[model samples]
Target: MAADLEQPVAGALPVKRTFLLIGTIVIAEPLAATILFPFIYMMISDFGTVQERYVGFWAGLITSAFFVPQMLMATLLGMISDRLGRKPVLIIGLLGSALCVFLFGLSRSLSWAILSRALCGLFNANAGVSRTAIGELAHNRGLNQGRAFSLFGFCNSIGYVIGPLIGGYLAKPAQKFSWIQSGNLFDQYPYLLPCVVSSLYSIIVSVIAILLLDETNQGISYPTLTGSTVSEETPSEALAEQDPLLTRLKVAAARIGPRNSTWYCIIGVGCVSLHAIIFDEIYPIFAASAGDHGLQFTSKDIATSLSVMGPIIFVAQLVLYPFLNDRFSSLGLWRTSAAVLAVVYPLFSLLPHISENHQGSSRIVQWVILLVLLAIRFTANVVAYTSISVLLNQVVAPEKRGTIMGLGQTAISLGRAFGPALGGTIWSWSLGNGLPPPFDFHLLYVIELLLALAQVISSLGLAKSQSVYL
Candidate 1:
């Protein structure tokens, strides 16, 4: 057992190349999941499954299938990742995912699409595995795990943004492009192009991963038992501090949750993750909905909003996340992010109201405000997510990192699973409730706002738990 404590030095790890490779691999899973967002309603409508009134609920179900496996099997995969090498599991997951995306794009019925998506979910374990691998690498190299995981989160946001961008443009490509061969496969299956593109990337990533990913897991023999553990503060960084803001955080956070420990950080992560995913899945649907009860946004509008959000979020993750984490407690970052969302969601709900009885410059002003708020919201999400991930990884022992982080992944998957499914059902209900113009969608935002506040309360509980302030 003591021999297991001795780890090989990271002297020849090719850290930079490994960073790029793992980041790419992690991006593919999310890209596949998110690429379906913009065209989901259209796909369901074409399937002729249920009434138009239930499109939101059903679209959400298809999306939820991607997460269902994570909730059920992430921990198992993570444990397997510990026994096997991270590289093989990663490669297999990516290759399997590519096939799933292609099948999903080609599905002629809702049942087929659902099965393809669930298969995609069941096959991929990159999210949990990557976190485990990154945590292992950082421990070996004595790197600040926060900055490393921030890059992982940065890669994550890129996938979310680009997936939607591709889905918006490449979906229904036969009509979008005039030069395409008419009456061919593209015309027959309009949404297949984006799926094909995503699948190709997955294939390429799988090949690169085979050539590049080092075996980060040392596979220590656990003959008796295994348990989760939180890594202690390294000599380079101290959890205890004398900063005024941290001091304020200590006092203000006196009643939030339990002490900042393994599962405690996971709880905070679970809440924030749920919030981010709900926004990701619901935004596209809301934007593409008809104006009667929905946001009345066109595909172009949805695309443009995401386009603006992409660079801002990317830059913030690259620049602002590390900068802010250096200055604030984890609880501090969580509270601030939740507070921002609480404000932004209410204003977002106001857009429908702004459209009615407003014209020209007034309408334009509302649009500009919405974009600015959205940008702020995106920045907050990146910061909070990166912060919590860093904390979650920090709270586990290096040897058991895979299983513990996998458990964390399962909790997060529950959020991802619940977010879209519930959001979609409620959205369908809201829009079809026969309420006035803004009231229907307005209810959705109100619910989001309250959840956002729950995040704030959660941070407070964590603070009061007297957890490690980092």
Candidate 2:
């Protein structure tokens, strides 16, 4: 472990092709996930399965369904990738998620939508696998891990931008555009267009991954009890064959790393992810709501607001992050971002109040304020996620990278699983109960602020405990 900590940073040749392939694969999950954001409210309404007041609840449930199974499966999948290799696991996840996306698009009922999303989450283990692959590929080549991960972040930023555009414009195509008659596949299934596009993107990426992506876990070795190095193939395979379940569980539990630092890092990332997801699930709903509390925006308006995040994130991740990563510790950067998020989260609740204060044409001022706040939040989130990823990857050994990354994903998935459901439930209750100020709609952002502060505290703990690594 000490030797692992002292490993020198390598300045080897770039693995552009491999990074490119991984980035392409990495973008697919976010693309598929965010595609539902813009139209989810309307889609739930179309089902007529719940009352208008409870649409938020059902929408939140469908969103949460995707993460519930993902949380359960992430660590297992990560462990599997460590044994079987990253490429196969990634391709399988991509293809499985693609099929689920199609099913989600075709869903006419809440049950089908929830089931499709759950299955999608169950199959989509690419999040951890791809991160593991990037870490391994960079470590193997002594390449700049920061740059590689930044590219990963860059791809995610693009997906976040493009996914909303696709969902906002392509959804309900028969109603939005007119060249065809009313009795078509798109007309019959209004949300199918974006899903088809998202699914096809995944299928194409999966095919590309099969053809081009190389396995990073191949040649990696681990230490045995007798101090001999065992090849990747023999140890895990032998252990699994010897004791299928218990040994693997024991090994996984053992490799989770120092509880103080490793778990802090995991918890820190999880907290940030929880608030970010809650914001993602609630923002559009808040904006589209018809009452004085909302922005009264359409799906297109929501999409446009979200689309602006792409370029902001692109600039932040590609340009600002590299500079900051070069100057400060990843832990330091993460801590700063968390502090900023603590300030930003509560500000979102103020948007409606800001708009309410201003009347008529001056309302444009509120839009400006909204975009500025979003830009800051998105920037902070990009910094936090990218920095924590680098920190998590650095904290573990190369051989256990997959498991650690998977554990990290598990933390994130757990937060996402509950963020939407909790956010939606609270939002509905706040509105329906006629709660007073601070207890009303503001309640959600207050919770988000608390999480951000917790993230800040955890980052401080991580810094103190892992000072040498930082």
Q: What TM-score does each of the candidates earn?
A: 0.87, 0.88
- Candidate 1 wrongly placed segments (more than 4 Å): 1-12, 220-260, 357-363, 435-439, 466-470
- In candidate 1, residue 133 scores what lDDT? 80
* Candidate 1 structure quality by residue, lDDT tens digits, 55-139: 8888888888989886788888888888886888889889999999999999778899889999988876568888888777665
lDDT of 2 at 413: 91
Model 2 pairs whose backbones collide: none
For residue 43, give model 1's deviation from the true position in Å. 1.5
Candidates' C-alpha lDDT: 0.75, 0.81
Q: After best superposition, candidate 1 residue 391: deviation in angstroms?
A: 1.1
List where candidate 2 sits over 4 angstroms from the true fold.
1-14, 220-259, 357-360
Candidate 1 shows a clash count of: 12
Q: Number of backbone collisions per candidate, in order?
A: 12, 0
